[model samples]
Target: MTHIRGEVLIRRPVEEVFDFVADQRNEPTYNPDMVFSERVSTGPIGVGSRFRAAVGSGRRPVEMRIEYTAFDRPHLIASTTTMAAAEFSGTLTFKSTPAGTVLRWSWQVRPKGALRLMGPVFGPIGSRREQRTWARLRDHLEAAAKPPLRPGPVPTRFRRAATSHPPAA
Candidate 1:
């Protein structure tokens, strides 16, 4: 099996980041390689949450069903696939830092049958692709989550500032 890992600093708090990650369906929104994703399990996300993610390959997208094997709040998540042609397992861990949250993603996979034959050709490529995927996820999450929004009306100060905008010539 070949393993690849990557990390990125996220702007959001650990808990918010953890929640987004815990929900498997959120991957497609960030990862450019993900063509689509859907949660196959019904219920709150936890150690048993399952999802099917289809990633866009060069020829066609491949769908893989994955289930969360472990989950720790604001910390760690480990999952493995239960789908054909998938001999892959992965973990994503988050840690608090002064700058922000450090999110790490790792995967180890062995290509079976026909895919194995191309290992020499695709192994390094896949490693790089996986790293890029994680980087995209980290960047998207951090950028999208900046300055949490509160559900309420605009304050008087904000209203006045908006109404007092410089008069157009």
Candidate 2:
């Protein structure tokens, strides 16, 4: 078992952020690795809604088809991946703040087979990877919802640990 947790404050409204993130389809814009995203089933959002997303833009990221295990609008959204290699469950919660909306995402992943063995070596790496991913997503979302700070400049990548390290992103 491995855990990766992160929280970011976004200027976007709670509902806006919640809605955008609730749908996996919106990830490509923020998370650079997510080359494609789409819902696998019907309905805008609810329990049983399914989705499949491709992760790596460079080398075709592993795809995962997951179904919503539970949905509590404007607050909690939970889902589980159907892939045998990876079991991913995540929850997103929002709270209003003076600065903006506080968006918190906690992910618990159980990598099976070969990936499981790397847990000890990569657990910390994965944790930081997720944190960086979340930070990028948050910055991108806020930047998109609001306006650009200057003429043009992408948000800086957030990597707490060295990219050369293991746990291959």
Candidate 3:
């Protein structure tokens, strides 16, 4: 079994960050390796919710089914994932901080079938990839929190009109 853990601090409220991360549909936005991801089960997010995701690409693409095992609103979430090559479980914990929210993620992966023999070689690569994913997640969350920029400088006419007194009520 291989284990990987990482943490990131996002400049957003705990509820906002937790809700965004808990929704499986948001995976592609941050996880570049996720070719596609979507919820397979209906209804609100909670224990038992399931998601299907295709990671990587080409002939060796990995498809996985993720089932939510634990869901604690604005705090923690845990899930089990099964794929043709391996089985893994992951947990994410959210904590409120003065600056923002701190997100901690961990995963335990166990290779199955013929893949077990290569675990030692793949483990470190997987861990590094996960860390990069966390960095992307941080960038995504922080960028989303920023206000959008104005299209351009205000027109001179509009600027002058604002400074001028109204002609009448």
Candidate 1 off by > 4 Å = 120-123, 146-169
lDDT of 2 by residue, 15-51 (tens): 8878888888887877777668888788668889988
Tell me the tens digit of each residue's lDDT in model 3 across 1-169: 8887888888889999999989988989999889899898988999999999999867776899999999999999999999988898989999999999999988899999999998886678877887888788889988987899869989999999888977776
Best by TM-score: 3
Count the clashes in each prediction. 0, 1, 0
Superior by lDDT: candidate 2 or candidate 3: 3
What do the candidate models score in CA lDDT, each in turn? Answer: 0.80, 0.76, 0.90
Question: What's the residue-level lDDT of 70 in candidate 2?
Answer: 83
Q: Which structure is stronger by lDDT: 1 or 2? A: 1
Sorted by TM-score (best first), the order is 3, 1, 2
lDDT at 59, model 2:
52
The estimated TM-scores of all candidates read: 0.78, 0.78, 0.84
Checking candidate 1 for backbone clashes, the offending pairs are: none
Model 3, CA-based lDDT: 0.90
